[model samples]
Target: MKANVGTLDRGLRIAAGLILIGLSLSGVIGLWGWIGVVPLATGLFSFCPAYSLLGLNTCRNRPH
Candidate 1:
């Protein structure tokens, strides 16, 4: 998969994911916080399935 997630987007995703995971681990948000794994994986992989389904791409160099 091409990198549909840009640098800023990826950074934010990673940060948010970490925060959610941290909160979950700390018992501040319960198991639902584990959902952060989705964003974390997408950020690290630079691809978002939902974005693809919605025909959206954040990468600047995406091909036409």
Candidate 2:
């Protein structure tokens, strides 16, 4: 899979995911906070399946 996640999107996802995980770990939120791992993993991988299906590319445009 190619990198469909752009820098900004990846940063946001990582930030949000980290916050979720942190909250859960700190008992500030429910275990559901761990669900943020999904976005985190996707951000790390830079490949989002939904983006692929939707033809949404957050990554930079390449020359044809």
In candidate 2 the C-alpha lDDT for residue 48 amounts to 91
TM-score of 2: 0.92
- TM-score: model 1 vs. ground truth: 0.93
Clashing pairs in 1: none
RMSD of 1: 0.8
For every model in order, what is the number of clashing pairs?
Answer: 0, 0
Q: What is candidate 1's lDDT per residue for 1-44, written digit by digit as tens?
A: 77799889998999999999999999999999999999999999
Off by over 4 Å in 2: none
Task: Give me the runs in candidate 1 sitting further than 4 Å from their true place.
Answer: none
TM per model? Answer: 0.93, 0.92
Summing lDDT over every window of 10 consecutive residues in candidate 1, give the lowest-scoring window.
1-10
**CA lDDT of every candidate:** 0.92, 0.91
